[model samples]
Target: MKDLTYRLPQRRELTTALPGPKSRELSARREAAVTAAVSPGLPGWVVDADGGVLLDADGNSFIDFASGIAVTSVGASNAKVAEAVAEAASHFTHTSFMVSPYESYVAVAEKLNEITPGDHAKKSVLLNSGAEAVENAVKIARSYTGKNAVLVFDNSYHGRTNLTMAMTAKNKPYKTGFGPLASEVYRAPMSYPLRDGLSGAEAAARSIRAIEQQVGAENLACLVIEPIQGEGGFIEPAAGFLPALSQWCTENNVVFVADEIQAGLCRTGSWFACDQEGVVPDLVTTAKGIAGGMPLSAVTGRSEIMDAPVVGGLGGTYGGNPVACAAAIAAISEMEEHDLAARALEIEAIIREVFEPLNGQDTVAEIRGRGAMVALELVDAEGHPNAALTAKVAAECKAQGILLLTCGMDGNVIRLLPPLVISEELLRDGLNVLVKSINANS
Candidate 1:
């Protein structure tokens, strides 16, 4: 297969209005053909993307702060990842791992086992998406422990699959009308330091108390948590919170699963966010940044637990696609070679330098997150969520050829998921646009 020849200039430029004529035409076609429920964070159609810039159909270049929702940490079109994918494709696309397993799948598994937290013997099951990994993790936990209760936190977004949708906390978009949802999933409170005003220990105690009273360890299968909650806002739990929960799980024989689908893979200035606290979970679900934008996810865990599932029970037809495996190997290598974890720290410094000062202002309630995965929460005069202002500011950024993404249950968060490989100049430029957009809108 021939590749598209496009070299992106490392800057943001817009010659036409927000969406050019071609993009408008394409949007019209998309409207007719695509499902109505499929929503886009950014309206324009991107023709080419490299590093941190997205080249849209209208000749407008955007500084991409949203790295395909944190999928392209190595960058939108990483040289090493692309080359690996191409080489793998040249060999053969798929002989299905469940049918005729290849070496790439095993290689990727070995790497995940090595890089992820804990030096203990670990095994991994590769899959197509984060949700699939989550489901499989739950299944493994249930199978090993012979329990059914699965606990999650508020503001968590697991996925759209039936089981994941039920695990998710949001009601309007993700869970509404999607009922007949899966059973045995429960929601617990999270450590929202801004809203709850509780210390990490206090938050942990509250959550644990509730779990003890409501679900209890005897019947609970697993507790799935994000080291840094993503869709619910990049709320980093209090310092002692994770350790406390982990200890409780250990004492109770309940599986502690870290759902690092959004915060893992050096995106949070560490190989895994759980490493920040030195908290090792029994099972970890990972995806977004794993394959440099290729659809790949893995449920990596202790060998004893992963081996609990029956031989035929765990395999899937598309579970460990060779091409995606190749991309993952290259992506992980790029992260290691470039020290993207340190780069993420640098990016955090730059972002905090700018947003930290605005905290006292009425419009900017708080800044949360670490590394390239950061966010700003907007508030109104009464300190309530200002979703309108958030929309206005994000729209202004889009108009100026800067791609941004908004999240949070209230729809009042402006998040930055810039690729770790983004140049300092382009990142700063995007931040400048963000500051200008905020100031203008505020």
Candidate 2:
């Protein structure tokens, strides 16, 4: 694999307007051919991507502030990642790690064990997506404790599967009309300090009280939570809430599972966001940013908990494809070599500096996040969330050659997840575009 130096390729425009004629033609065709639910976030269609720029089918160059929804931590079209992927593709594609094991698969698992938090004897199992890892974590927990109930927090997004849909909190896009969800899934309130106006301890106490009174701690198998809620608007738990919950879970038999699918892999300036709290969870599920954009997920946990499941219970045909595993190995090496954790902190600093003036503005309700996983919530003078303003700002940013995304239950927050490997100049350029867009829209 080639070495990935800090390089920013020059940006050029070959077309006068975005979606120039060709992209618009193709997009129209796609609108007619593809399902309505399959929607692209950005307005234009992408034909090619390299460095920090995405070339739309119309020949426009747009800076990618959204790194494939935080999946491509190493930047798009990274030479090292591409070369590693090509080499693995040439050797073999799929051997099914379960039926026939391979070195790359085991190597990825070993790397996950070493990198994820907790000093206890750790084990890992690979899967295809974050939801699968989360589902398997619950399965392992149930098998280990012989309990039927699983606990999750409000505004959390686990996955799209039936069980995960039940675990998720939002309804419009994820759960609407998808009734009769998996049973034994319980929901609890999370620590949203900004809106709830509760300290971490207070929020934790409320959640615990609800769980103890309703779910019965003795029947619970696991308490799954995102160290920092991703799809829910980058809300970080109150400082003491996670530690207190960890202690409670320890006292009780419930396993503490950290769903770091979006916040892990140095995206939040740490290998695992849970590490920030100094509390070790029983299991950690990681996927996004794990393989430099490859489709790979893992469930790492204490050996005893992982081993509780019987043989033949936890294997998937395409769980650990060789190419994805190889990419994982390369991605992990790149993260360490570049000190992306520190770079994430640098990205956070830039965002804070850019959005500092907006803090006192009436339209800007809150600016919160850790490391590069940052967000800005929009509101009216009365502090009511303004999803329309958030949408308008994002659309303006996209038009100005910057791609951004909005999240949260109300769609009132603009979330930024630039690749950890992005250059300081490019990162600031994107943020400048965002600032200009916000100012113009506001």
Candidate 3:
């Protein structure tokens, strides 16, 4: 297969208005063909992306801060990942692992096993998405413990699947009008230091007490949590909260599951965010950045817990596709060779330099996050969530040829998930645009 010849420039340049004429044309076609339930984050239609640059249909170049929602840590079109994907596709594309296995599948699993939080003997089962990995993790936990209850926290976003919808905290968009959701899923308070004014230990105590009173530990199959809560405003629980919960789970024999779908794969300057806290979970669900934007996910954990489920209990036809596996292998290599984890730390410093000063401002409530996965929480004069302001800033940034993403329970957060390989110059330019927009909107 021949490859595209154009070299993507690592800068932001807009030749036309926000949508451009071609993008508006494509938008019309999408309106007729695509469902209204699905929405595009930006108006521009992406034609190509490399490093931190996105080329849209109208020839407008954008600086990427969304990184496809943290999936492209190695960059949108890393040479190694593209080459591996093309080579693998040339050989063969699909042969369901359940029916006919391939070496790439095992290789991906092996890599996951090695990179996940623990040093203990571990095994992995690949799947199609983060929600699938989470569901399968619950199944494995239940199979091993023979329990019924699953515990999650406030402001958590597991996925949109039936089970995850029940696990998720938000109701309006994700769970509303979809009643009779999966049962036995319970919610507890999460550590929001800014909101609660509590220390890590205090937050953990609050959460543990809620779990005990609401759902007994003995009855819980697993307690799933995000080390650095992603959709929940990038709230990194206070230092001791995770360790405290982990210990409680160990004492109670409840499987501690870390949902690292967004914070893993070196996005947080560590292989897994759990590593930063020295809290090792029994089962970890990873996706998003794992395969460099490929549709792949995995549940990697202790061998005993992973093996509890029957041979055919966990897998999908498209799970661990060969081409995706090849991409993962190459993506992991790029992460290691370039020490992107360290680069994430550098990115965090740059972002913090820009956002930290605005923390106590009228419109900026807080600034929090780790490594390359950072965010700014917007609030009104009375400290209430200012979703309108957040929307305005993101829209203004997009209009200026910089892509940004927003997330939060109240939709008042601007998250930064820049590609790990983004050049310092491009990243600074994007940040400048974001700051200008925020100031302009505020």
**Candidate number of the best lDDT:** 3
Model 3 misplacement above 4 A: 1-6
How would you encode candidate 1's per-residue C-alpha lDDT over 242-309 as one tens digit per residue?
Answer: 99999999999899999999999999999999999999999999999999999999999999999998
| Better by lDDT, candidate 2 or 1 | 1
Q: Candidate 2 residues 36-86, lDDT tens each?
A: 998887667787776567778676877787889888888777778888999
lDDT of 3 by residue, 319-344 (tens): 99999999999999989988888889
| Alpha carbon lDDT at 125, candidate 3 | 92
**Cα distance off (Å), candidate 3, residue 41:** 1.9
Candidate 3, backbone clash total:
0
Rate residue 73 of model 1 by lDDT.
Answer: 92
